[model samples]
Target: MFTATPSHNGYSKTQSLLHESFWLDNPERPSAKSPVNQDIEVDLVVIGAGFTGLWSALEAAIENPNWKIVVLEGDRIACGATGRNGGFVSASLTHGFSNGLSRWPEEMTELLRMGSQNLEEMGDRISQLDIKCDWLVSGEIDVATQEYQADELQQVHSEMNKLGVSAQYFTAEEIRARIDSPIYQGALFDPQVAVVDPARLAWGLARELERMGVKIFEHSKVIELQDSGTLVRAKVGAHWVSGRLVVLATNAYPPLLKRLKHLIVPVYDYVLVTEPLTSEQRKSIGWLNREGVGDSGNQFHYYRITEDGRILFGGYDAHYHGKAGVKPEFDTDPDSFARLADHFVQTFPQLAEVNFTHGWGGAIDTCSRFSAFWGKAHGGKTVYVAGFTGLGVGASRFAALTSLDLLQGRETPRTKLRMVRTKPLPFPPEPFRSWVIAWTTKSLQKADRENGKRNLWLRLLDSLGLGFDS
Candidate 1:
């Protein structure tokens, strides 16, 4: 009945087999995690062990070690998108200034600026902590895939220049010189972006939090919440624990949070990692293998080269998902990646037989404006943050702080942002949802091919079918 069916390794994601191919699967969680044990009480309980949860625990710990901080995770720490992301520590947020301004006023302008700065600060923290996350001080190429996209990006260019964010607009030849890909007319290269091993960094932070005396429990899938006379209680299996406050950091897994379920529409995004490329292969593409890259297709596609010379390409433009269900192709599901792979190979013909050795998918929580949703709740104790729209890697830290602000009832950098709450498309489950998502996939793909961007009315129709139901 749920949509967690595994998209890789012939397992279902909803079956609790989410750990095997996840980044944490490759390397052990930074700290040894104890399985859920007897009922335990703490001053604060943080749900989810991803970046936000880990940071929450860490911040709480620093704020007051005396206050017992309990971190609960459904899976291993960093097992979710925290470890599975493109690892672009974008000094800026996912939503550009213009995008934010359109949805919100200057409230998010300085706040988002702070978020960008926070990403850089996190990098410094990693370096200070000496976490070997394979971080690289590189830029990003936000390529424009269509004429309309190019036009919008031109506005982005002008805005970036006005804001002193330091971005460059490359010509088709300029981009082609950087990489063998010829699919983009131009790109926005920003120096503030950096690439890192996401899983490693997240895991490292988890371990760091543990060393800081934070209590982390895995297999502690919190199934319910309770409001005690004096504290909030979260249920795990047969036990219930009480805490003064609770933090919900579940991003794409918002469904488990019950109240936040309707606030997020879980959509799956697929990723394919290519086998290690040879020197000839790498140099032939001239990707420098250093920059984080993504295109401006209507559905949006993001890609980057890994530390091992492999390419990680993934996006959410094609998955066939429902409000509460999912239907995917077993092999080269939906035929989007295969086509994308073919396009990649053609762009750089030096790599032959380029089969994706590892392909995986995950859920992303997208709101109407694709802006993050962060706030405090449950009588100023249950703080929560989610809705990154595939761009949470860097901002998650700030988002956590935002959640904390809500929890503490204090002014924070997070409260300065605002995103429109979009009601999810009201479509009953089943064949219709699958059909709509399938149709959306086709229409978007076609639009991408025909114009590198979707038609406006087509976007309206697609958006109509997307978003969380309030």
Candidate 2:
């Protein structure tokens, strides 16, 4: 069911697209603040002003009102994956229920409870702070594009219900009545997900942090971290911010800690946002509820309707550029955009005339386990977190809180979980790393084409707990 080559219509629709994220393309975006010019001392220093960093600062300031907190960002706030995501705020901290069930079935119940609590607290904080980010609590539907996938989704649905999770399994005819997609064989709908303007959420958190007396510096990248006596010194340009504790929230970017260099690989994902749909075009799709939709595949697509009725379609091709790392030039991939455009048209033939106005790509910090891992450096004075894969929007707050718990040496419920106590199996070093990822990608694509049958390579990875079930 995949389009082998993009047609002329697909290519033409994206010919004049803007290479920027639709969420960040806002006129009301705040201007960048001045970077650190001189040495400063603070109680807590959080690096990177994305969702994780902002949430860390906010929570820290709330817990200790008098503590001096400083946030350092390399660019404007939320310019990285934080700004370039599909904005699905899921409650599953372990990527999804099945992934968590597979990896740590013993603590899956606690993990689910903690994830749900984290999401509720986040929503409460957003309401308490009055952060306007087009927050919508319209749940998510994982649709099966193939018949085998439907059977798999049904199994997942049954398992979820047994765990006291609320879910609805939709048949082909039942789902088509709701979403009007031709390829949906069946679907599993989880009513615990939400969507937001992610960039705006980050910005609003930054605004609230500043209002709470947290000092923030934009365009200041932390190049080095050193242990200076009892305090950790973060070098931003020529200036140093010395702090009693530091939180590393730099997800997907090159890490300041050397050990992290092998624990994560920045894999690029692309997205396309179409212009707002007219009334006639809107009626053609019949997506009145505007729920976030994702296909059930190893390689899949996630699409949703924006506030203004535009469709934000992303995922499918996860590109790893060997060791080029994260760079501005890799933000645009024409082939990925064309493929997405073709897939979009195929999914909604009535929207064949729709044109995309924005196209972008950003890297996701992929780990072997496809979830986050936490560690401390400089003898537990500095705590760091990465590897949220692509589902960090809501989990970032939990990560922030847990990192704080570690920095303060507190034995909270969040710290005792096996998922928190253990780390993912490190990825193989360079050359071989590239070879492994390439082969994995090829095998995943092959499986998608062959009725979800895993070959030896994928099965081996699955046995090793690295194969992503989607």
Candidate 3:
């Protein structure tokens, strides 16, 4: 919707950027787990081995050591959004404070507390399990490149202070001192966020689950799930596996359940990673803390320094293909990569010589509310969680635990929350879905360009509490 023709000259020099994730391109990636070979029965069966599935398996295994857990993956672990994200582990379970406040004003305090606890527990797990995934609690800084955004950040800073959340507002000069980006007008720093090597985190979780005696099968796609009397039968290739309980952790893919089609849409998000910065190059940009940086725009860009000093820049253009399905070919979009590269140079003119070494894209499970929702099927024997939008790196753990609670019929603090008890407005089918998405995308783009002024269509969507984002 926000179309910007990229300059062919700058991108031409980096035409052959690798199509793999920088976090996943390591030589230490774990070998694939064996696929399901024969009929099997387990206490619990988990589908889709991303963060949600891995965390669900890990939590279930820890809760009941004797419960035989089996995880099925269509491909290798972390090969989806788990591997191809900007890796900003955030504690905001409702996407962000503003979104949380707007959606659940009454339960925001509890949600915030739970989100913070989730992040703390994640840190504890990483330490306790010795998962060396470059877990840096470096926090995040949201910068404003426009005057209107700067005013908005100031208001957000005040609101956060009132809400008892620790935050700091930086002036243009102050923010430029922290990260020498010429485009920065102001910034808000939140200390509860972290950046990590996402692929390593996924791999560590998989290894720990295996250590806990959970059997994980790679290349074993669950073609069909039939709800039998007391068990759910899943067809995986030539094998049929039955389980007492099933968890559907598949996000943004062609779901095994038809109900999920209306609740989730695969919005492709693009990213580009620059080669590791030299000492002098890093010094030039004064990012001493290496906190994750995101622009304050409807169409925003999230950039961060990887553990290896490379800058992973992503976001802005969320592409939705017709039919809204995730495919391998959608992972690399030349135009999106070029636009990102161009923006990177605009943000930091001093780094114009730095060429991107990797460019890739991943599908985000976007819902109307821009947060996750939970549901059950097959008479409560099966549970599913999806629509993480774009902030599931940390919240997936919470979703996993909550899904487990739902499947086991346990009432906990997380399960009692209204956010979990409700579902987002389902998207209409087919042509209407595509038209609404395109119109909303265009409106969001217009808002960003017009000093954040919402159009009538966006206002109507806001009134109805229905909108789309990635």
Candidate that would win on lDDT: 3
Cα lDDT tens digits for candidate 2, 256-336: 999999888999999999999999999887888889999988889999999999999999989887789999999998888
Candidate 3 residues lying further than 4 Å off, grouped into runs, are 1-3
lDDT, candidates in the order shown: 0.67, 0.92, 0.93
In model 1, which residue pairs have backbone atoms overlapping below 3 Å? 4-14, 5-13, 6-12, 6-13, 91-116, 424-467, 424-468, 424-469
* Residue lDDT tens for model 3, 145-253: 9999999999999988988999999999999998998889999999999899999999999999989989999999999999989999999998899999999999999
Residues 198-294 of candidate 1 have per-residue lDDT tens digits of 8888777877777887778888888888777678888888888678988888886745555555455566676667777878777877887489887
TM-score of each: 0.85, 0.99, 0.99
Write out the backbone clash pairs for model 2: none
Candidate 1: C-alpha RMSD after superposition: 5.7
| Residue 67 lDDT (model 1) | 79
- Lowest summed lDDT window (length 10), candidate 2: 461-470
lDDT of 2 at 147: 98
